[model samples]
Structure formats: structure tokens, C-alpha cells
Target: MLTVSNLYVQYGERILLDRISFMVGDRERIGLVGRNGAGKSTLLKIIAGAQSPDEGIITRPGSSTLGFLHQEMNLPKGKTVLEETLTAFEETNKLEERLEVVHREVATRTDFESDGYMNLLTEMSDLEHRFHLLGGGNKQVEAEKVLKGLGFKDADFQRLTDEFSGGWQMRIELAKMLLQKPDFLLLDEPTNHLDIESIIWLEGFLETCESSVIVISHDKMFLDNVTKRTVEIELGKVYDYKASYSGYIEMREERREKMAAAYSNQQKVVVQMERTIKRFMAKATKTSMAQSMQKRLNKIDRIELDDEDTAVMNIRFPVPPRAGQVVIDVRNLTKKYGGLTVLSGVDFKMDRGDRVAFVGQNGQGKTTLARILVHQLPPTAGEMKPGHNVHIGYYAQNQAATLQPNLTLLETMELHSPPEMRTRLRSILGAFLFSGEDHDKKVSVLSGGERARLALACLLLKPINLLVLDEPTNHLDMLSK
Candidate 1:
């Protein structure tokens, strides 16, 4: 079991976590959830030993191990996908090599009564046992199995890791983490880079895996499928429920309702006490009685309802200028890099005001098509024509990463916005849940979800009728998604 006691975390004046305490039972699957900037990722980093808490202690068995997969990871460039994943079994590989050495020593020694010969034989036996227990014989098969489960193909296994995009590299990292099979798994936004089928595969994989998992994901269905418990962080406090995401949502609502009711009742009592105190104060003979009552009222602990943000983003695209009926037309579109063809003779048309979605597994050219639509890439052959007066607002998968790290949130938005938008910038940010001191926060300090929201907020400053979003909801919370 993993236990967190009196955990405290603070950034500047904001108390991200306030003396929170929780426990993860053996083999438990927990869904760590909260809105953007609620410190869900921070908590995961703390548990993974990547970050330190301001105050608190985490206790677990000395032999227990942890594997963490976060958004940002630097993968070795020269290694192939399979080879990189097999690095998880480095200890096993070393043990196997040592076992071979000891086996050879035992075979060559002819002195049956010598202590050295007998010791060599015993060492080989122990090494063999350790290697078998670590699944040394099946390391390659295990690596392939995990890679395939995460949407990798058998053909792609031999491809260089650096040849793939960031999303594919992230999958490689996840495969390594899964292969390690640590006692505790801390995954932050694990579904962000996964396709629908891969997400399903991962759900089944986690359900059967022996490792206890604490996953932070915005995908509600994924959480519901994989997690057995939900831990929510809100207003620097935590609410734990022995239920999945769907059940936790219902239980949280019930808790909020109870808090509201108690707050209402307390308000009534507070009002009554104030009224009685005022009446007694009006009489000179009862001044002492009023003072006593006022002291009692001051000592009363006021009930507070849980504060939840229910604000909805109101987004309206700008009217498209007069244009031809055909918003976009493509014929025999083909794209190739070297000998590999990502898109082959793709043909499609979109009329004005029509919405279309390109869905496929990673590396299947979904993003390539989006980029092509926005004129970001040139097709090797065929044609893509846009209607007259067509204006496009594109949000790339790496839009948040493209933001200037040194600029404050408001400044970043101001740079992208038109002069007319400047007047309503705060309101626009408010719609996207950035307000008050949030505007002053530097982009570098924002979490993935917050940066995504800020990036999206910038796009809305001057929208076009044709809005092309690639993996737009990857980093957003459920409400924002």
C-alpha cells in the first residue's frame, strides 16, 4: 500500500494542495481528476519523485518501485522502437549475461571437492532462478506485445524512434513504462496521444496488469473503463470516492448538495443570532447579555459549500465572407516522405458550413490531412483548391507548444488578437476560464491543459468560418472537452 499523509503543496500564494491525505491500496486503480490548473499533474509528479512537496510524507515498502509516464520525455534518438522498449529489462539482461559466465565457469572447473567450483555452481543456480523470475526468456515477446497493444505495428517496431513524431515517441515511452511493470504506475494524460482503439486496448491491459495505477486523464470514458476509484482535487482540498469516474461524479454532486443544505441552515441561524443580539443591545440593562451572544456568534464556524466552476465557454465563429459554394475541394491528393506514403490518392470535398472529421490510428495521415487543408504542407501530386475569400483558423496539435514561453497569458493573447479584440480580451479569456491573476501567469508556468486553453483562447480572437482543429481536446478537462 502507498500512503500519503498531510501532503502540502504551494506555488506563490496559491495553496495547490492543503494537507491532503490519502492511501492507495495494493492493486488499486485510481483516477486522479480535477479541472485545469487544479494540480492533478503536480500531485502525480510528487508521487513519481520528480517534484517535492512543501510539507508531507509518503510511505511505502522500501522494495516497492514506481514507473511514471508524463507528457514530456526525451527518448534516445538512435534506438529502434523495439530496442528502446526492451531497455526496461536491463536488469534482467545483465542477470542473463552473468548467468552465462557462471555456467561456463562451473563447466570448466574439474576439482569436485574445491570450494570455488561448488560456489560457482551455486551462483549459477541462483542466477538462473532470478533470470527466470524476471521473465528474461520472454523479454522480446513482452516488448512486442506491449508495443502492439499501444497501436504500434510489427513493421514499425524496427523503425528508428527518432523517425516518428512526438505522439508516436510518447507511445514508445508508455510501452517502456508498461514493460517495466513497477509496483505503482503514475501516468499523466496517458490517453492524450492514444487513438480510440489503442485507448481501449490500454484499458484492458491496465485491468489485467498487476501494477497499481494512478492515471490522470481527461477522457471520461477511459477513466470509467480503467479506474476503480476517483480522487478529486478542488480548491486545495481533496475528495476521495471508492468509485469509478461516473460514480464519483454522482457522489460528488451529492456531497455538494449536502454542503449547500448545511450552509443554508447555518445562514438562517446566523441571521437569527444577529437579530437577537441587536434587540438586546438596544436595551441598556441587557448590554452584557448582548455582548455574550455576540461572542457566541463570532465563535460559530460557518459552513461553506464546495466551490465548483460551472461557467461555460461561449464560442461563436466569425461570419465567413462571401465565397464560392465549395469551401474545399481536393482530388487525387498524395503525400510521401522518401519511400513511405502517408496519404495515397485521397479525394474529398467540403461544401460551405459543413463539418467533417478525419479519424484513424496514429501515423494514418489524419493530422497530415488537417495540415494539408490549411496549406501547411504541399501534396506530392494532385490538387487542393479553396473557395474565393476563404479564411482559415488552424489549431495545430502542438499549438500550445508554439506559444511564447516568456510571455504572460494576457500578453500572448494580445499578440495574436486584432485591435478590436484587444478591448474584449479579458472577457474572451474569462470565457475560456482564465481570469484574475491567471492572466498574469507566464505561459511557461501553465500546465498542459491550461496552455491548451490559452492557445485555444488565442485562436478565438479572430476566428474564421473554417476552423481546423487537430487533436484539439487532447489536453482539455471533461468540461472543457
Candidate 2:
């Protein structure tokens, strides 16, 4: 069990967490919910001891250990997926090593009745038992179970960790966390990189996993399936609910309505008090009442309602100008990296107004073809040509990363926007939930979702016939998606 009391965290003039307090019970499944930048991830980092709050006390038993998995991870080079995963049992492996030493010494000694020899037997037995309890003997099995559960096949177990993309790399980290089985687990946006099947698998794993968990996720069904309690952070305040995510949502609305009423009533009372004070202040006979009312008004701390984050994305691809019947024509298309062939000789054609979808396992030619169509990647053999008057707008999977980090979000939009469209930049940003102060934020400081939104916003600035989008919704919130 862990307890956080009177926690406060602030960044410059903006407050992130304001005197928030909550307790995580033993084996409790906690869902930390809040809008982007509401400090949900901040609280998790504090609990995991990776971050220190500006003011607060986090009390936990000395024996309790913490495991943290965040959005970004550092992968080890030259290590296979299974090897990397097995490192989670570091402590248990150390115990096994000590046990081996003790066994060797005992076998070499002749004084069986000596205290030192007898003590070696006790130590060896204790170490072996501890190692067994930590699943040391079955580390491979445990690691394999978690890897497979996270959507990794047996063949992938031998692949180098660095060989996979970011999403696949995330699975490797999650597997390590599950393998550790720490006393407490803190996961931030754990399902951001997971597919639906992996999410379901993780939900089942957490349901039976003994460790207490606190996860910050936007997946409604995922939270509903895995969590037993919910902690919401709104307007720098904490609302604790002993219910699932769906139940918490219903109760949160009721609480919000009641708070709205209280705020309304307080505003009316303050207005009435001000008028009464003004009316009585001009009369000397009523000076005492006027002065008392002035003091009351000055001391009052007016209630503030929670501000809703309801920024909607105003995104639509511009209609391309009239083009020839054939939009794109590909002949003998083939792509190869060294000796490996990704896409063998193939022929494809797309007419104007045609909508096509590419579906296949990862590492296939889906993204490769998308890039080839956009002229970002060249085919190893053959050629692809767009019809006359055809214009293309491409949104790559990692398009956000291509943004200039030194530029402000506003500046990035301005650069892509033409003179005639510059006036509409603010409105366009507001649609993507970036407005007011957000426009001034540097691209380096934007979250993954924010960057993705910015990238998509830029895509809508130009008119094009062929819109090639690759995993455009990967980083977006559930509502945005």
C-alpha cells in the first residue's frame, strides 16, 4: 500500500497539481484519468519515485518495490528480445549465482559437522527457495508467456530489440515490466502502442496479476476491463471513486453538475452582497454594516468550476482539382533492400476518386508503397507515375518527428500556410485543440498527441488529389480518433 498526502507540483506560473491527495490500497487497480497535460503522468512519476513533487509526502513500506513503464523506453543493443526480457529477473539470478557458490564450497569441504559447513547448507537452502519463489527456475517460461501475451510470436523472441519499430519496442518494455512482477506497477499510456488484441490480452493479465497497478490510459474499454478504482484529476483537484471507468464517468458527471450549482449559487450570493454593501456605504448611520459586508466580500474565496477541454479537430483534406481518369499507374513495381525483397514485381492502377486500403502484417510493403507513391521512397525496380494534373498530399507515420523542433507550433503552421490562409491559422489550431497559449509552445515540448495533431493540421493547408496517410490516428486520443 502507498499513500500520497498534500501533493503539489507547478511549472513556472502554471500549476500542475494543487494539493492533491490519494491512497493506493494493496492489490488495488487504479485508473488515473485526466485530459492531456492534466498531470496524470506527473503523479505516476512521483509515485514511482522517478520525479519529486514540489511539495508532498509519499509514504510506503521499505520492502515495497516499484516498477515504472512510460511512453519512451531505452532499448539495449546487441540483445535479443528474450534475452532482454529475462534480465527482469536480475535479483533472482543473483540469488542463483550465490547458491551455486555455496554448493561448490560445501561439496569441496570435508568437515560436515563444522559450523561453517552447516551454515553453508542453510544459506544454500535459503537462496534456492528464494530464487524459486522469484520464478528463477522458470524465467524463460515466464518471459515467453509475457512476450507472447503482448503479441510477440516465438520467432520474434530471437530478433534484436533494435530491429523493431517504436510500437514493437514498446511491447518489449511492457513484457519486461510484467516479468518483473514488482510490488507496485506504474504504466503511463501503456496501450498507446498496442493493438486491440494486445490490449485485451493485457487486460486479462492484469486481472489476475497480484501486483497493485496504476495505469494512465485513454482506452475506455481497457480501463473498464482492468481497473477496479478510478482517480480523476480535474482543475488540479482529485476525485477518488471506488468504481470502474464506466461507473466513474457517470458519477463524475453528477459531481460536475453539483459543483456547477454550488458555483452558481456562490456567484449570486457575492453579487447580492456587493449591491447591499454599495447601497449602505453612502449612509453614515449604516457604516458598521457596510464595513462588515466589505470585510466579508474581501475574505471570500469564490468557487471556480472545472474548465472543460473540448477542442475539436477541424480536419478535412482539400478536394484535388479535376484530373485524368487514371490517378496513378504502377508497372512491374518491385522494392528490395540488399538481398531481401519486400515487394516483388507487381502491377497496380488507381483511377480518380478511387479509395484503396493496404492491409498486411508489419514489415510488409504497406508503408513502403505509401512512401513510393509520395516519392519519398524509390522502388528498387520498375517505375510509378501519377497521371496528369494529379497532386499528392502525404502524411507519413513519423511525420510529426519531421517538424522543426526549434519552431513554435504556430510558426510551423504559418510556414505551411499561404498568405491567403494565414488568417485562418488560429481557427485551424483551435479545431485541433491547440489554441491561445498552445500556439506559442515549442514543437520540442509538445506531447506525441499534440505533435500528431499539428502534423495533421498542416496536411489540410494544401489542396491535393491523392491523400496518402499512414497510421494517422496512432497518437490521437480516442475521441479524436
Candidate 3:
């Protein structure tokens, strides 16, 4: 079990978690949810001991271990995939090393029954016992199982991790974390880079694993299927619900309704008190009563309502400008790195107003083709032609990274807009739910979803006939999407 008491985290003057506390019992599955900037990731990082909190005590059993899977990480290179994964069994690996040390001592010792020699023998026996108990001998079998389950083939096991894409590198890290068998696991957006099949496999693995899991994901279906409880952080507070995401939404709505009613009743009472004071102010006989009523009004604490930050991004793709019948045509498309052909002999054609999707596994050239179509990359051996007047707007999967961190939301919006179009900035920001105080927040401080909205919002600054979107929905939450 894990218990957090009196937790307080601050970002300058803004409170991320204000005296918030919660617990994750053994074998429990928790879904952590909140708006993009609501400190969900911060709370996870604190619990995993990846960072420190301003004030908090996290209590756990001495035997318990934590494995935190952060979103951004760099895996080590110069080792084969199987060799890298073998490092997860730290206990067994240490035992094996100690045994090697004992063997060297035994080889040098002439007196086998001496006190020091006897102690070395005892240590070696204990090490072997613990190693065997931890399945040290079956490291290869276990590693292969996990690697294959995560979509790595047997042949891929011998390849250096550096040869893989960033997504696959993250998978290697994930595999190592899984093999460590921690008592508690913290996963932040684990499925963001996974394909559908791999995601489903991971969901099954998470369900059967004995460790307690706290997963932060925007996939509503996955949350409903895997998590048994939901914990939401909003405005520096936590709301605990002993149900799945769907059930939590229902209960939360009911809570909002109750708060609204209480606030309305308080307003009515305040209005009535004001009327009574006004009516009695003209009479000298009721002066004391009027003063009494005024004092009561001054002492009253109004019931605060929950004004949830559900910013609506009120915008749509701009209407397509005039273009020829055929928007783009590709013939004999091929992409290669050295001798490895990622895409070969591919042909595709897109006419005006024709919707298409290039869906496949992680390294299956979907983004490669998109880049070629957008003229970001030249094809090695293909003819990719754009029809007359075909203007393209491209949204790369990593578009969020291009945002200016030091600028405020309103400032960034203005930077992307033309001088004459600057008047529509407020309306545009409002449509995307960046209104009032949200407009003043720096781009560096915005959440993943918020940054995504802002990046897409920039696209509306100009009109184009065709839009090339490559994983444009990477960091968006369900509501934001």
C-alpha cells in the first residue's frame, strides 16, 4: 500500500497540489485524469519519487519497489536488445557477480576450511539460492517472452537499440521496467506511441500483473477497460471515485449539479437579506434590525461553485481553396536507408476532397510517405506530383515541439496571425478555450493537450486546399479531441 499525506506542490505562486492526499492500495488500478494543466503528471512524478513535493509524507512498506515510466527518456546504446533487457534482474545479476568474486577467492585459497574461506563458501551458497529463487537461469526465456509480447521479433533481439526508432526505444525501456517486477508502477501516457495491437496486448499485461498500477492516458476505452477506480486533480485538489472513468463522469456530474444548487440557494438568501435591509432602512424603529441584517450579510461566506475549465476550441478546418481534379499522385515510391528499404514500389493517388488514411505499425513508412507528399523529403525513386493550385498545410506529429515556450498564449496566437487578422485573436483564443486568465499563461507552462490545441489553432491563420496531418492527435485528451 502507498499513502500520501499533506501533499503540497507549488509552481512559483500557482498551487499545483494544495494539501492534497490519496492512497493506492495493493493490486489496485487507478486512472489519473484532469485537464491538461491540472498537475496530473506532476502528481505522478511526486508519487514515483522522481521529484520532490513541497510538503508531503509518502509511506510504503520496505519491501515495495517503484518503477516509473516517464514520457521522455533516452535509452542506452552499444548493447543488443536482449543484453539491455537482462539488466532488469538486478538482484540476480548482483548475486551472479558476487558468486564470481567468491570463485576467485576459492581459487586462490589453499586452506579450504579456514575461517575466511568458510565464510566465502557460506556467502556463495546464499547467493546461488537467492539467484535461483529469482529465476536467474531463465533470463533469456523471460526476456524473449516480454520482448515478443511488445512486438519485437526474435531477430530484432540481437539488433542494437540505436538502430530502432524513438518509439521502439521507449518500448525497450518499457520492457525493462516491466521485467523489474516492482510492487508499484507509475506509467504516464504509456500508449501514446503504441500501435493498436500493441496497446491491446499491453492492456492485457497490465490487468494480469500483480503490481499496483497508476496510469495516465487519454484513451477513454482503455481506462474504462483497465482501471477500477478514478482519481481526478482539479484546481489544486483531488477527487477520488471508486469507479471507472465512465462511472466517475456520472458521479462528477451529480456533484457539479449539487454544488450549483447550493450556490443558487446561497445567492437567493443573500438577495433576500439585501431586500430586508432596504425595506427596514427608512424606519427608525427597525434600525437595529437593519444593522443586524447587514452584519449577517457581511459575515456570510458565499458557497463557491465549481466552474470546470472546459474550454471549447470553437474552430474547424478552413474550407479548401480551388484545386485541380487530382490533388497528389505518387508512382513507384521508394524510401531506403543504406540497404534497408522501408517503403518500396508504393503507389497512391488523392483527388480533391478525397479522404484517406495511411495506417500501419510503428516503423511502416506512414509518416515517411506524408513527409514525401508535403515535399519535406525527396523520394529516392518515385514521381510525386501535385496538381495545379494544390496548396498544402502540414501538421507533423511533433508539431507541439515547435511552439515558442517563452510566449504567452495570446502572444503566440498573435505571432501566428497576420497583422490585419490580429483583431480575431480573442475570438480564436476563446473558441479554443484560452480565455481570460488562460490567455496570459506562458507556452512553456501549457499542458500537452493545450499546446496541441494551440499548434492546430495556428493552422487556421491561412487557407490551404489540402492538409497533411501526421499523427496530429498525439497529445490531445478525449475532451480536447
Stretches of candidate 2 exceeding 4 Å from the true structure: 98-130, 261-304, 316-320, 323-325, 329-365, 378-385, 404-406, 414-431
Using lDDT as the measure, the top candidate is: 1
Off by over 4 Å in 1: 94-134, 270-302, 316-320
lDDT by residue (tens digit), candidate 1, 1-481: 9998999998777889999999998899999999888999888888888889999988889978899998778898899999899998987878888987877777787898989887887888887876775568899998898899899999999999999888889999999888777889999999888888899999998998888999999888999999989999988999999999999999998988999899999999999999999999999999999999999999999887767766656675555566668999999999998898999999999998798988877888989889999999999998999887788989998899899999998899899999977888888888788777788989988889989988888997785778899989999888877
Report model 2's TM-score to 2 decimal places: 0.80
> Candidate 1: lDDT over CA atoms?
0.88
For TM-score, candidate 2 versus 3, the one ahead is 3
Q: Which lDDT value does model 3 have at 111? A: 90
Please report how far candidate 3 places residue 133 from its true position, in Å: 8.5
- Superposed by TM-score, candidate 2 places the C-alpha of residue 284 at a distance from the truth, in angstroms, of 12
lDDT per residue as tens, model 2, 105-159: 9889999999988888998888887677667888999889888888898878998
> lDDT scores for all predictions?
0.88, 0.85, 0.85
RMSD of candidate 2 to the truth, in angstroms, is 4.7
Per-prediction CA RMSD (Å): 3.9, 4.7, 5.1
Q: Where does candidate 2 clash, by residue pair?
A: 312-431
State in Å the error of residue 416, model 3.
Answer: 6.5
lDDT of 2 at 142: 86
